[model samples]
Target: MRLIKAARALAGASQDELAQEAGVSRQIVIRVEAADETVTVDAVEKVRAALERRSVVFIPSTAERGPGVALSKTG
Candidate 1:
């Protein structure tokens, strides 16, 4: 999904980096991001956790705006 790509970008990570962090293959990340394959919830969770670790937060869509990602503020 676009959110995944946005989150990765916000994290300043490549697909390979995210795959490594998520404990999945680069191919898996490709497939997931392409939105052409069905991935397991666990796999999705792994990707989310990896992104979260990098301070990438996923925000659900609101009527005013579509779903998006943002980097967490740091002191």
Candidate 2:
């Protein structure tokens, strides 16, 4: 993913280094890059924070709502 690549480049960090900083194992970072489903939200957040420290912008995904539609359900 671009996020992973950007994090690695911005920190001048290897997978091992970024994994350590993000409190995950090198294998986890590799799996995440490979788009493995096993990666957890906590791990993603840690990696995102590490990238954010280097001024990388992380834009989270939001549900696609049609125009004039509210997310919440109302009676």
Candidate 3:
């Protein structure tokens, strides 16, 4: 989805880099980013974790920020 691709960009990671960091295949990253089909939660979590480590934050929808991803301020 857009969120995944944004997070990858925020992390300065290519699909191959994200896949390696998440212990998944580059195709998985591509499929996820494209939202072409359903992917497992575990796969999403792995990709999320990889981005989080690189200072990407997944913001839940709220009264303020809304739902999205961003570069962590602390980073």
Candidate 4:
């Protein structure tokens, strides 16, 4: 995932370092960076946490946003 690599770079962490921080193997980082489709949620969350620690903001895309139900402002 570009996000992972970018976060790792931003944090000045090597792949191995990031893997260790995320409690995963270096291979997992490599696979994730390569956009492997089999990545797990745990791995993604780990990377996300690592990025968040470095103040990396992750905003959900519009497509990934919830259904288009409107919210009442007075609620």
Tens-place lDDT per residue, model 3, 1-75, is: 899998998899999999999999999899889886688878888988999999998988988765898898898
Q: For this target, which candidate reaches the highest lDDT against the unseen true structure?
A: 3
Ten-residue region with minimum lDDT total, candidate 3: 35-44
Question: Which ranking of candidates, highest TM-score first?
Answer: 1, 3, 4, 2
In model 2, residue pairs whose N, Cα or C atoms come closer than 3 Å (at least 3 residues apart or on different chains), thus clashing, are none
Q: Candidates' TM-scores?
A: 0.91, 0.65, 0.86, 0.68
Candidates 1 and 4 compared by lDDT, better number = 1
lDDT of 2 by residue, 5-75 (tens): 65467557788877888888888888877777878988887876665665555445568732221111221
lDDT of 4 by residue, 1-75 (tens): 676676567667788877887788889888888889898878878866765665555544586573222222332
Best by TM-score: 1
Off by over 4 Å in 3: 63-66
Which is superior by lDDT, 2 or 4? 4
Off by over 4 Å in 4: 59-75
Worst 10 residues of 2 by lDDT: 66-75
The predicted structure with the larger TM-score, 1 or 3, is 1
Q: Residue 12 of model 3: what lDDT?
A: 91
Measured with C-alpha atoms, the lDDT of residue 31 in candidate 3 is: 83
